[model samples]
Target: MSKNVDYMVAIPARYASTRLAGKPLADVGGAPMIVRVCQKALESSASEVVACVDHELVAQALEPLSRQDSRLTVCMTSQNPRSGTERIAEMLRIRNIDPQTIVVNVQGDEPLITRDHIDEVAALLASSGAQMSTLCNPISSIDDVFDPNCVKVVMDKDNFALYFSRTPIPYERDNFAQGQQAVTELKFKHYHHIGIYGYRAATILDYLQKEPAAIEVAESLEQLRLLHYGMKIAVATTERPPETGVDTAADLERVNRIFASQGK
Candidate 1:
């Protein structure tokens, strides 16, 4: 494995989430969720870690963490951007980041992101030679497979993503009328899409500039924009499923429990 690559983990921390307002700055243990995400990425062998926040209050909350670690670069992006990808693009443009830089988009809500998952997604992009890369863990249980909240991904034989849907895809005909319990015995395979992504600096810029595709609007999936433009997305299978991301108060409690279990 080549460790010399100049990969930068950019965590896009938006403070305006409707589900949990000021979510990125929400307290987890003592430190904020965004800081936890940045620190997790910093654990990886990436060259740099940055928090691309849209609000000044978020930047203020991140200030102390910036002082603690020189690796934490705080960047202010547009507060009105349509998506996380747009915010990252704006930050790259303002900073005049090198086009050669390999940037990874890490969601701020994911406080428990692991280095192994980061390295796995990054390595997939490097080895597959694809413009963009993301990860998904196979769904073993029926509960997660049927939940609409759990976005499912179907991939080609080569592991390139064919489509992403909120609906339970490859719908087992035998289990359609029966329900999740009966589907488990049908020898079916499903996958849940992970929120992390790895892409080149230039590829992201190009993607943001393009118009939103029809499928993207219907499904509310940003990855569809890449696929709509006919860009091949390589899917790397993660050994471990992702930890809970803090989208609501209940989610925060779940993350806190995970941290307590680890004695953090």
Candidate 2:
């Protein structure tokens, strides 16, 4: 990957989450979760890092960090963006960022997200010249393959995504018939899709304008919309899996324990 490729890290932080209310403001270590997420983004090779938030309190929470780092900024976005990608699209327009600029969408709740993975996705998009890029990790457990919460992705030989679904793809029919344990003894590797994404500002805008695909609506996966429009999404495998993101109270507790152990 070229060292000179300029990219921006944009995080979408919405205050109201059904599972974990005020998720962005949740305390992790000594700082708010959103602030911790911003710190991670700042550690990346991106030229700029902006947290796109829905609530004023979320922006206020990021004030100290944004003031300390020139590269960090906060943008208050619409409260009702259908998804994080849409919020980022709104932010791009609000900030008047150059359409050609590359932007990486990092979830605000993932405080443990590493700079290496962030940079990897951005570098893949920059070097591959694909419409978008993302990372995935090999599924080591059989439970994750059947778990609807864990989205699965199948890639072509070129490492471009062929399909993404909640249910397993390229189903090992013979192995599955032997039951769950047999499925684990796979002939090919199954992959869990990481949510992070890299795309040009213009690509995001164009994506928003396209009609949502039926498969996207059915599976509740936004990336499918891009595929419906014939966009290429390059995928890379990551050896190091990211720490869990805070989604529920239990997840928050788990992440906090991890932070405490790290002496954060």
Expressed as tens digits, the lDDT of each residue in 1-264 for candidate 1 is 527555888888888899998898888977888878888988887877888998888888878878987888999888777678888888899899988678888888999999877877777788888888899988876777788888999999999999998878768776766776666454678889998899889999889889999999998888999999999899988768679688899999989988899898
In model 1, where do residues sit more than 4 Å from their true spots? Answer: 177-184
**Model 2 CA lDDT for position 206:** 95
Indicate which candidate wins on lDDT.
Answer: 2
TM-score for every candidate vs. truth? 0.94, 0.97
Steric collisions counted per model: 0, 0
Candidate 1 local lDDT, residue 80: 74
lDDT of 1 at 5: 57
